[model samples]
Target: MMACIQFLLLFCSFMYIFNVNPSCAQIPNSPIRSLVLPVTKDPATFQFLTTIYHGTSREPIRVVLDLGCPSLWLDCSSGRLSSSRRLIPSCSIQCAAAKPNNMSCAFSAAMPTRKRTACGLSTENSIARSATRGELVEDILTVESVDGSKAGPVTTVDHFLFSCAPRFLLNRLARGAQGMLGLGKSRIALPSQLASKFGLQRKFATCLSSSDGLILFGHEPGYDSIFGTEISRSLMYTPLVTSPDGSGSSQDYSINVKSIKINGKRLSLRQKGIGGGTKISTTVPYTTLESSIYSTFIKAYKESATNNYFLNMTVVAPVAPFGLCFSSKEVPSSMLLGPMVPVIDLVLQSEMVKWRVHGRNAMVPVLDEVMCLGFLDGGSKSKTSSSIVIGGFQLEDNLLEFNLGTSMLGFSSSLLTRHTSCSDYHTRMMQSTLKDS
Candidate 1:
């Protein structure tokens, strides 16, 4: 009896320590929901989650495996994201079919070297030399099977190209989405090993929405699942959140409005929009959305866009935008809907100074200041130089809100002052006049 009691007690202790609270313990380690990250110039690397889909059946059987680090390379011919790209036929080799050096030889030849230049940007660097009139390059995922011992040769068709890029630049500058996956039947792209090893057979699906339209991923049914690290975690990636189930539901995320102080007066920022939500979008054109408000405020202050004046102050939280995942679309809807992932409202940790303008008099003070930060685009051949690109500044909401023509200047809240009054100028101009008198 004594021995039995000791054993029972030990077992109970073990269970308690593990918190074998079946309900919470049952939750899979993988995030049920897939987060949409903001478009990044570099790449994301990590040991995240993976879901496998079979081409013929179009189903998701499992999603829990380790995808080693993957690289998302830019398609030089067209400035867009790409996983394992096609080899230029010219790069083909004469290796006998028996030896099968096709994949190796082809990849070596087509991979952009520091020597190639396309569209004014070096194919080697992949960064746009001058902003072009084409599609915005977005996410580039490279997937490989972790279970290499069991699989045969991986096929080229096994790769995928998801269409997700900025729409405005699509026709003007973006490369035509080269052989993008059609959401048609029986087409497959996810690396085969993920299916065989992880038991992930269902084709996971999601829509990257934007002002443009909904973008389907996993290609209707067949799609490529690049195995490896995401580009953002590896480079300069902004943060973002995902729905709990990876369902892409808007309700799953958070958005916060910290404080709204107008002209040194505090106002409870609790106004709701049409849907009883915090944010509302007007059909107004981008240029006009804030133009009229800005104009009215500046004109009243007798200033120009160059002049710093009136502002609407708002504090924001930080969340990663999702649009960064797809770069192959002629006009990826992600550009419209994915980039703004209410990080501010969702996290509610940090505060951002919003430069808002209401009707007339400079309600908010103008903080004239400049700052310099660092930018890192790791893909550049020169890693050191690529790490410090001299970015911009940032502003806070103490007494003023900072802004430029329409750019995110930076995060510095330092202010600049002007001595426009003749009296103020004369004080500096004629210090001797006052002393002599």
Candidate 2:
């Protein structure tokens, strides 16, 4: 009897020892790298505008690509129809460790030059359209140098397929992200095909922020750095941001956070180091808020209490008190569902960099009220700029806020909506309950 009991206990212990954590199995590693790859702070992982100009005739097709994929081209001998057909194979390759970059190429036979009829336009209109089109042709040949050493001539590529959207869609792009490039870690993607051509490693990382439509791509540098005065300087003209106040003061300002409150009382923040020994510089500050924001949301949920319909305010707390009010549809609630933003928001103001213990692992705190207006084309060698404003704050502490001055706060006024098609359920509800009477 004793031996039987001992044997059973031993079996249970062995089973427990061998149990594997499902989460650990799935994630594979801690500190998962982001998809938008540029790890460097300077020149910050090239998201640049690329143009494919047909040889000699000066026709060009425009697109945006991560600079990390060095090899990108357009095949001209093939007409647009054939070019798209031929390039499909190249675009279909899988991205793997063995094959690093996803070099997806769209093709165009020639640049659009003559305009015929947009309803009814004559040759005079065509000539004006041609001039506008001429401005889109980017000169392919230029010298690329870093620290006085020539990386090479910014080569003019040919015989590749490039995509041009309907004219209206093209107009929606910022100056540079106007076209597509090969991203995605697939074999047919441009990054993999051009990996050897551009001396890129097998895998490039890209970090994409929904708040800002900025894609950072590049190999991780084994050093610590910062986005310096230069890159920030060039960002000004990049059409990425629109309607800036032009007062330079806002440029230097980082995020400003109001006090952190829990149950309406505030909390203090303290910094802690991340990596130790030689990696000691990485650090982050943390503080737990007293407010049971989740609890409040639960109460709202319970009061409204329909299993099919529920509400959650997606926000990182510790934002400026006023900035926590209005919500923007543009902000993705899922992405900001992390602990970093609110903790950082408690200490810093918009765009300001507050050192998190070690200068290495810092977070850029942004005002909660600020909303990002995707990309504006800052012209001439400029990348896109993300615009923000100072509106949309929570007065009762549960409202959503957008910092950008011109974003949609609550819904538009009923008077304004009388002329437009604003028939969303929320709009209808507001109309039925609040305005119809």
Candidate 3:
């Protein structure tokens, strides 16, 4: 009996050392139900940034939130190096999961001459259109936890996979941002890792604004009430479709836009239906439409503003990026939304499932006295690849939930209409929690 007991003890010790049981590796009975990241928009670049604590020392790293990127990568040359970081072997299971097609080790000038095996990954700067090779590595990642009503304590993921790129890749990104946090539909992306590690739902939500906003991983039922009505109740969902040309594995979130409308009237487009050429992007600053579509859209908007909203509004000289500009005095401002202007709608699967763009989202103030239409004209359908690219400005102050499990995108149009903005919601939540604490 004593020999049997000793044998059992030895077997348990081996299991503990090797982590044979995945459940034994995690923090037992952890109270964290969801993760929250604070999002802030850069004034100069107009790109949104989110903070995440990484490494054993818990270094806070600010990364641009890119909806199109497939993986998370940082500038390792200048960024702090974590002592706990470990490179995944080229032939390991983790490396296979990250890059199944490429198993060969990466070559870097910085690497030692001594032979070693490490997984190679290609990190790309979508803004600069540059690509660099990096090695796959895993380190501790910490994020703020939330339990619905308030922010909880920080939670740590034992092993988070990311690549380390060279410093030059940081060019064209927002100032102070060291990396890009990819929220795309890839296995190695942030949402996938968080969901897998925490056993949470495979969904994430983004709320972007000029000031600090919130990005929540896994649905927080409490946040649904921030808009005065449950956000889910107000949310309208549209099926997320894959890109054309048979690239179903594309990381970007795309939706089918049936038609475009200005002030409840549909615009006459060169193409009858825009179809599956609309995508959501946080990197692009303004909504971009194909040249032909833009021409018809701008003409319809001008007519609507002149005849209905702003009578005899003065048309000012065009801004550099905006083709249509109007005198600020002619446009009326609303306390709830923004400048009172004609609404723009992107009719989705059905007319009733329209993604409405109100005055606040459709207009941008370029000069003190001039406000211009926020939409931009992408040269042609061939050049742009998409008929409509929904950019960050249009997404600001809107709550967008990407449900990967259901392959659906849920959106709440202009939280300002609900008498609250993204920045306001985040500030209110923090203040209320502080008071309670």
lDDT of each: 0.21, 0.23, 0.80
TM-score of each: 0.20, 0.26, 0.89
Model 2, 302-360: lDDT tens digits are: 23222213333343333432113223333233321222122112222222222121101
The TM-score, computed over Cα atoms with residue i paired to residue i, of candidate 3 is 0.89
Q: List the residue pairs that clash in candidate 3.
A: none
Model 1 ranges off by over 4 Å: 1-254, 262-437
Task: Please give the TM-score that candidate 1 achieves against the real structure.
Answer: 0.20
Candidate 2 Cα RMSD (Å): 24.7
Better of 2 and 3 by TM-score: 3
Residue 168's lDDT in candidate 2: 34
Q: For residues 1-437, what per-residue lDDT tens digits would candidate 1 score against the true structure?
A: 65564444444433332223454232324312111111101112111122222233322222211111011122234332234333222211211111122233233554455113211211111112222222212222322221111111122113232222233322211223211221111111222212222223322322111111111122111211111122111221112222222332221111222333333333322341111111111110011112222223223222221132322112222112210111111211122122111111111224333433221111111122211010111222121111111111111110110111121112111111111211222132234333433
